[model samples]
Target chain A: MALALDGVSVEVTGATLVRELSLTVESGEVLGLVGPNGSGKSTALRCVYRALRPTTGAVLLDGTDLTALSLRDSARSVAAVAQDNHTELDFTVAEVVALGRFPHHQGGGALSEHDRLLCQEAMRRTDITHLADRGVLSLSGGERQRVLIARALAQQPRVLVLDEPTNHLDVRHQLELLSFVRHCGLTALVALHDLNLAAATCDRLAVLCGGTLVAIGPPADVLTPELVQRVFGVRPTVVTHPHTGVPQLLYTLTGENNP
Target chain B: MTLTKTTADHPPARPTRTGLALPVLALSLTLVVSVVAGVALGPTVVPLPDTLRYLGAALTGGTIGADEVSSYSVIWQVRAPRVLLAAVVGAGLSAIGVAVQAMVRNALADPFILGVSSGASVGASAVVSFGLFAGLGVYALSAAAFLGALAASALVYLVARNRTGVAPLRLVLVGVALAHGFQALMSVIVFFAPFGEAARSVLFWLLGSLGSATWGALPIAGAAVVVAVVVLVRSSWSLDVLAMGDETAASLGVDAEALRRTLFLLTAVVTGALVAVSGAVGFVGLVIPHLVRILAGAGHRGVLTIAPLAGAIFLVWVDLAARSLFAPRELPLGVITALIGVPVFVTLLRRRAYLFGGR
Candidate 1:
């Protein structure tokens, strides 16, 4: 595992937010974290991203404890694309992407030629190269998400963690973003609210319930109808995509098994 | 989600390099001219030629001849100190303004918004009304004000900071509450003062004045502004990250909590030093940084550099007008700042779509 959460837990004011959660994302794999709302997926991910420290155990990267590294050093290898990053300040798309180079350059000089080239490449990969000069505030929801993703990519991290990156994105953009993430060649840990998307895209899925990890395996093995009913309280008819043979969940609103 | 609200049916206008550079250069030049104008055109109206000669002589450490003595006295002993004080105070307030806005991550925050000014006013009023530090004598008011400013800022920080960090919104709320509390304390002190003359002086002092400019006070304020501006500019990149919110900043390798605490203390110290000498010069700290952002970009590097120069130029002229426009009965500097600043800020808001580096 390139990234491993070793029995990590988070307790805030005596309330267990995440309880002895453990998971691993091997090198060059997309691991999907799925659970119902308030299942502590975000809390567990926060430990990996350094937004919050685990109460008991450690988050290890490449067998080394992440807490042992400086934030700048850790950030150079682990980048995140979070759900709630809104700025009223009008930074240009290129400038926003350039901020990713901050960890690489500690002495605070102007961006090097290589840094500019990296930002340009990241923007191009995220398909926002044309919006380079436009203010990020002027971009649409989908465009802004791409800009943020570009910033994360510019970080050039070995491991990328995204929390609900597709929440505000439309259907086609969502599919395209996930597919892009899959082929981006970086070990990824993605938290998704949509079960079908997690099934279609992720190599494996980790299901969290109330704070503890209940199951972790390939989607076809772990996202069974019984497990879906037990964890999410929704019965999902698992189907195989005719084209890709990936497990695709068909959810029913009206059925004899309703709630 | 295409709630695209365009300011105009035009292209997004990024701040051009030439656009920022030209104005920064012009402002730099204007600041130089304003400093000379501030010294030359004061109440006594020292002749421009003699003012030039005195400045040159002072720079070269050469004593003036007998005939240029009166001009030398006016230029060196009186107007120079006043003008320099105005420039330093202006620069300090403006620099602190930029930092505080970034520190709190609010566009409206200023040096005084943290209750530092009101806290200092209370201390100055205490010295004036009750002679709280009678032993310090001439240095009493400034010392008391500095201590008070530091104390109030510490209180605000303690109240606002949380386990996660000092959230920007919490900081602003706590700062405003403290400011109001300190203002009431100041008013209570002024109301019950035994001497009517002392009360009036405290009122003038609260309104802010550079009338007490002295050779003794100049070095302290000068050193403070220079050091603060240098430190802030050096940390401009960290400040830019901080504005992106605490978690985002932390993920990007900046320690948001530690950085913000350091900035809060730095701003308090700088603001305390300035408020000690100049009482609370308003508008410069609040508006100058925004004005700089509008002309330049919202990046801290440009804003921090331009704010001090713009602020220095602005207050020099304002002070020049304050002293000379009304002759011997000088208007309080804060009154003039608000008078000019409000109309100018309103004009900027109405006229510019690119205010705060947004279009």
Candidate 2:
């Protein structure tokens, strides 16, 4: 599904967290949101997922206003892997994945055969089918992250929103997870702290600096050395990956190198 | 991190239908046994055979012969209503415990955590001492207590909520503070009661009792619990999602704030009705849900269904012990609950820290 943010702005207690941001992810594309620690990537994502209402402008899913739809209907269209998707209670992996079918069963019926199959398929796709009966809290960080991703997949959403999904992953798991996201064929909006991974994984990149959108385009154009140095305040050397030919950045500490 | 993927052949999935049915059946059977034992083994020690005959006749709307007059009155008029009230109050408390815990997103919340009990105490004390709402005649005390409980919960909601919503921590802190405030107020009213008999009655009500259990009041509490349990069971999935967290629940298409608010009011009414009649029988609400969650998974459907049955069986035995342990002198139900509940709760906590969804 196509997702558009039209001048969406979020103000919490007289402070603007996201300012007049307008961006669009076309159907079946991976759009990466990259920024410094507090540059409002998460804030913008929150507005899309309806965790917070935009102070101004709107979020549209396929030309319909998101706020106008019931949360259940909107959830059917969009699924999210949020930053704080940690479970205190220990639900089995299957049970966690089955919760994704919740929006479909709002009228209160047992899970149908189709729903159960969908959950099994989601677990298999995320490669956690073996852990189906295991308690979520017993899993390693990477395993837990994959379980959450499986849950999002079980929703069978048209649009996906992920906030820092790679935070808990090792380097190998990180690549596998992003590869799955890339091949899943869903329109996705993902926030990434690792610029090299973002450049490698995203079809397009939107860079934010201090609540404003600074650059947005194909990854090669968006990750230019000048823009990186200016926005990130660090000297960056960009190199093309040997296999994929995507632009990858190697950063140097400016003060240490100069001294 | 050492991550070894499991490649062992997975066992066939357990049938969900049988899982829920077995526990429910066991608990239901236990409840039946408790009721029979409770009625038969009281101070009078009626034989089991005669007790069953009397129960069978009473249930079928038949009368016994003149020789069974004493047994008839003892079973039908006295023990039956009291035992049924215990069952109703037990089921209500346990179910409401699940609702309140999920509503506030905290494991510590119970039916009375939001000051409902203390508020009920204030109202009951006023009625006992100053003849407040005496015009309502038979319902005056219960009516005042229910109103006070509801009012206190409403006040807690109004006070604890911020611009966004009631954050769980704030709700806990606000509820505890207001509960203390209400308790102090109850104490002040009891201290200056105009008569010694009024003070004694107020004290008795504060400690809790089922002595007021009557055929007239049983149906009201029973009807309230039935309605509340039906509503809770229907929304069980929503409760499961809500317990995860607000944002996750919203992402799953549940309006978390709206659901929480609805549960708050529903629990208030059910708990208000319970406290009005039973005077805040304490540990049943606090301990029973946790025990159920330990035995069953944290799924609301399973926990909510089984907790009521478990609670009913538990309270029947507790009430039995209260009435018969020191024959002719009855113990307050609250005293017996804490006396039993504390030890069991501590043992469970120390008995290997298995997660709620254990293998």
Candidate 3:
């Protein structure tokens, strides 16, 4: 499914958090939304997942307005790993993952064999199969993140919205997670802070600054030194990776900002 | 990776279906035994055989000997209704406790946290002290309390909601604030009562009693509790989804706002019906759900199923102790629950492995 945000704006408590943001992710493409802190990246992603309705305009899935569909219908196509994904209860990892099939079932019925298989496959793919019976509250941060991703995968959604999904991951897991999202072959809109990782994994990058889209294109065109310095307030030395040929940014502490 | 290492070090011990079944079965059986003991062992202790004979005669409409008339009357007319009411109110409180905790997503939340009990208190106080709802005669207090409960819940819902919906924090804060206000209102009503006995009786009602339990009061509270249990058990999965936060619930196609509204109304009505019949019984709603959760994990279906039976058994014994411990001068039901609940809850909290909602 292709997700399109058409002239979407979100204003909360007299402040425009997201301003007329229009963008589209082609079917099965990974679109990275990158911005500095408080640049409305999360707000835009919230709109796609229907966590926050746009003050104006609409979000469309496959050219049909999201509001036109029932909540269950929309959820069948879209799943989210939101930034505020935390549970106070001590649910086992398998139990939490099985909750993804709630929209598929009715009235607290037992999970069918098909639903069980999907949950098992999701846990296996995320390498958290060993932790299936472990209480989620006891797991490490990285393990918990994988469990959440597995839950979203079990939902079997065509469109996935993830906000800061790589926050608590180690370096290797971060790369692995991004790679998994890349090849998962879903229309994913991921809000990320690491421009370098976004450049490496995402097929296209969309940059936001002060609640508006500053640029959207291939990583080579969008992650230029001037744009990085202007948006992120840092000096970067951009270079191609030796093996992958993706742009990587390097910085030094003793730069022009020194007093 | 550390993830793999941690998993290997602590091998998973999956909780099987039989694990839940055994505890549920045990609790159900305990409830039955407790009900029998409740009816038999009161201030006027009837012998076990006579109690059984009375119960069987009443159920089968069989004739009893002339000498056993008073014993049969005591068992059938007085203790039977009181014991059944305790079971119904206990089941309702425990079930609604699970709902309220999940609805607000706070481990400390109880059925009365939404101010319904305090609201009911104000109404009961008005009737006891000021003679409100006088025309209703036998039912005046209950009628007034139910109305007060509904009014207070509506106020809380209105105050806590915004354009988005009722945030859990806002609901808790609003409920606590309004609860205090209602408590003060009840105090004022009690303070201005003309006679000393009126004040004393009002205090008894506030602390709670099942002394007034009769066959007439059973159907309303029993029906409300049954409906609530069925609805809550059906929504168990959604409650789990809702407890994860509104964003996650919305993403999963469970309308968090709509579900919250429904839960608020359902819990409010059920709590009102219960408080109207049994007064403001405490501790069962706050403590039973947590006990069940610790024993049965945090799944709502298991918690809802087992907590009611556990609560029914616990309250049956509590009511027995309430009537017979002081003998001729009955202690309040709330007093016994708190006396027992405080020590048990504190001990549970002191355990190294038990956190309120987590390990």
Candidate 4:
């Protein structure tokens, strides 16, 4: 599937959060959106997830305009794990995972055997099958975040959108979650604050600055030290992985004699 | 099956002692005892067996006793429906209270806080003042109140809902504004209508009464409660996810928007039906749900079943107080519920940490 934001612009209260931005994620490819705070990175993803409508432009999934699809149909097509994961109700992990089948099940209808298997498969993929019966209210932040991702995975959507999914996760789970996303046979759009993690997991990188697509290409081409300095306002040493050949930037605070 | 976990997610184990058997048994026993006491303590007291005999006659479809005529008539026809109406209204209010509080994720929210009761009152007052159903003369006031209740909540929902979703905070804010508007309009009507019929009718409604219960009102209250209970029980699973907030619910594909709207309307209709039959009985909806939440955990399965039972039992006695606290007359049911529920609620509030929502 081809995912494209064609000339996307988002405005809230007469102010533009993201403007005239466009990018694409090919089938089975992972595209990373990286930018500093307030740069429209999350806003652009929000437009794609149908959380916020665009002021102008449109999102297309496999050549079909996303707007043309009903919200439920689009929901079945794309699943989201957003940063706002706070919940007031206490549901067991298995119950939470089972909710991913809601788009398919109507009133008084139980999940089919196939749906149950999918829920278990998704939970196992997230390494959360052990916590299946645990109350979500009692889980730590990192564990709950994984559960959210697992819930999205259970949706079995062709495309997955994650906005800062790793925000509350620990270092190890963060790496594991991203690497797992990369290995999953699905198109993924991810917003990340960590440049190194983005470079490592992303097949292609799109740098967002001031609500616009400043640069889009492979990590090597788009994440130069100069680009990092220009967009993130931080001086970073650029290096390549010893075996994988992916460009990774290591950041450091510049001091009096640093330049 | 036991939940497998080396590490407890929430180390502080939830107090799960609040279960079905005890609370239900307690409620059933309370209803029996309360109803009996209510019959025994009313004006022109009858013996216990006589009371039972009269009730049994009603149950077994036997002839009405002569000595038990005024006493039995007063107990069954005049007073029993009134008491049952209290229980019915209380059950509906408390159930709606639990649902709405869970829906909006607010602890302080009661069913009527959404303008349902006052809206009913306004409608009741309008019908009385204008004589809408004087020709039909059957259910003029109640029909008006039910319609009014539905219209007010629907209006509040429409005003609050936006493209993003109907956030609980927005819904409550809109509800408060709309309720004030309804009450203001009601006040103006009260000022104009005559004190004997129109204005006095509105006053009785404001105080909330089971005193007005008639055989006519029974079916409406029964249908509403039955529908509310069925719809809520069927959707108990969703209520758990809903408490988690919209983002998580949508992510799970629970159709968060649709669920919110559906539950909101359900609660409104339930409230309208209760208000129509029993007037504006308050405090039960606000109190019983919290009590159940504390005991049974916030799971909707336990809450829906337990809150209604608790409310129904509690109101049976509260209505008894309304009837027997002064001889030969009855106080408003709302006053008794507030008096009983408020103290119990405060005490319960002090008992636990009382946090709401998923961590």
* Per-residue lDDT of candidate 1, residues B1-359 (tens digit): 89877656534657444434777788888888999988899778877888998998988998789988888988888888999899999999999999998888788899988889989988998999889999997899999999999999999999998887788889999999999999899889988888887778887887788888888999999999999999999898888877777677767888888888888889999999999998988888998988887666677777888899989988998999888888989898989999999999888867665534244
What are the candidates' individual DockQ scores? 0.55, 0.45, 0.61, 0.35
lDDT of 4 at B84: 72
Question: Candidate 1 — which residues are off by over 4 angstroms?
Answer: A254-259, B1-11, B15-24, B63-67, B355-359
Model 3 Cα displacement at A84 (Å)? Answer: 0.6
> How does each model score on TM-score?
0.95, 0.93, 0.95, 0.83
Model 2 chain A: lowest-lDDT 10 consecutive positions:
A250-259
On lDDT, the candidate that comes out on top is 3
Tens digit of per-residue lDDT, candidate 3, span B1-359: 36544435343554644546778778888888899999999989999999999999999988999998998988999999999999999999999999999999998899999999999999999999889999999899999999999999999999998977899989999999999999999889889987767778978887889998888999999999999999998899999899778998888888898999999999999999999999989989989998887667778888888988888888999999999989899899999999998898778766534444445
lDDT by residue (A108-205, candidate 2, tens digit) is: 67889999999999999999988887766677778888998888888989999999999978999999999999999999999999999999899999
Give every collision pair in model 2.
Answer: none
Model 1 local distance difference test score: 0.87
* iRMS, all models: 2.5, 3.9, 2.2, 3.6
**Number of the candidate with higher lDDT, 1 or 2:** 1
Candidate 3: list runs displaced more than 4 Å: A254-259, B1-14, B17-21, B357-359
lDDT (0 to 1) per candidate: 0.87, 0.86, 0.89, 0.80
Q: Given the true complex, what DockQ would model 1 score?
A: 0.55
- Per-residue CA lDDT of candidate 4, range B1-359, in tens? 99776853354645434346777787778877776766665666778887787888888998874765888887778766766776677777878888888778887799887889888888888877777667657588888888899999889988998976798999999999999999989888877875557776678777877776776787779778978977887887677667766765554445577888888989888888888877788788878888887666666777888888788778878877887788567788778888887888788767754445633
The alpha-carbon lDDT assigned to residue B145 of candidate 4 equals 89
The local lDDT score (0 to 100) that residue B35 gets in candidate 3 is: 93
First chain TM-score for all predictions: 0.97, 0.97, 0.96, 0.96
Model 1 earns a TM-score of: 0.95
